[model samples]
Target: MKIIRSRSFTPSRAWGALEIANMNGITTRLHWTDQPYKWHVNDGEEVFAVLDGRVEMRYREDGIERSTVLETGDVFYASVGTEHVAHPLGAARVLVVETQGSV
Candidate 1:
């Protein structure tokens, strides 16, 4: 067993991640980022949970762009084919769960 302190975790670079687990083709990771990610669609479902700081989650719904601010402890679920991007208000830690090798 392992104990992870999400708030204290830091990455060497923006958007860097630490792999936490891989079970039945599903992967869990902890990520640190201060920059915004590019808009893209996940090949499978994705769960993004903010552990620290804030994030502005932007997505496209029915070709209309929308966004929401996610604070610490907020979780965002992205279904397959959902176009989205994440812009952190500052340095933030996030827990992400998705299919292995998915982008």
Candidate 2:
């Protein structure tokens, strides 16, 4: 078992990243920050679990684009080759689980 305090974690201009645990096939973490209008490219499928506050996700679809808001306890997944951007809503926080190994 491992513990990571949110405040103790570092923040990045693009997005804050932290490794809460890396055991077996599960990689868990609590990542939070105030970065808006930035696109994120994931090489593999990843799960973002909202822990607190809110967030807005913008992504492109079949010749169309869309945006959605996710609140506490809400979850979303990003698949490989999917381009998307996200930002926090009033100091948002989330626990992200990367099911597919890093690229």
Candidate 3:
């Protein structure tokens, strides 16, 4: 059993995460980041949830770049082959669920 206070979590680097669980081949992580992540397509689906602060989610759909601001409690779903990136507004904590070893 594990209980984490997302509001008090801090990362040591750009995008650092704490492993929460790994069920089957999927992984659940709590990440604290202050920098933007590179755009990449995941091998499987991904669920990104903003736990604290806000983030700018950018993605490429139909070869066009699109973006949306994700406030606290907002969730973003990215299917396989959907290229996307995340940019935090200041510091933020996010909970991410994705396949193990997915990029």
Give per-residue CA lDDT, model 1, range 3-37, as digits (tens). Answer: 99988888889889999999999999999999999
Residue 41, candidate 2: C-alpha displacement in angstroms: 2.5
lDDT of each: 0.95, 0.73, 0.95
Question: What are the models' TM-scores?
Answer: 0.98, 0.75, 0.98
Q: 1 or 2: which has the higher TM-score?
A: 1
Return the number of clashes found in candidate 1.
0
lDDT of 2 by residue, 1-103 (tens): 6566665565664356677787677788677767674676666677887777789878877746788999888888988767777777767777777754653
Can you tell me which runs of candidate 1 are displaced by over 4 Å?
A: none
Identify the superior model by lDDT, candidate 2 or candidate 3: 3
Error in Å for residue 20 of model 3: 0.3
Tens-digit per-residue lDDT, 1-103, candidate 3: 9999888889779788999999999999999999999999999999999999999999999999999999999999998889999999999999999999987
RMSD of each: 0.6, 3.0, 0.6
**How high a TM-score does candidate 2 get?**
0.75
Worst 10-residue lDDT window for candidate 1 reads 1-10
The collision pairs in model 1 are none
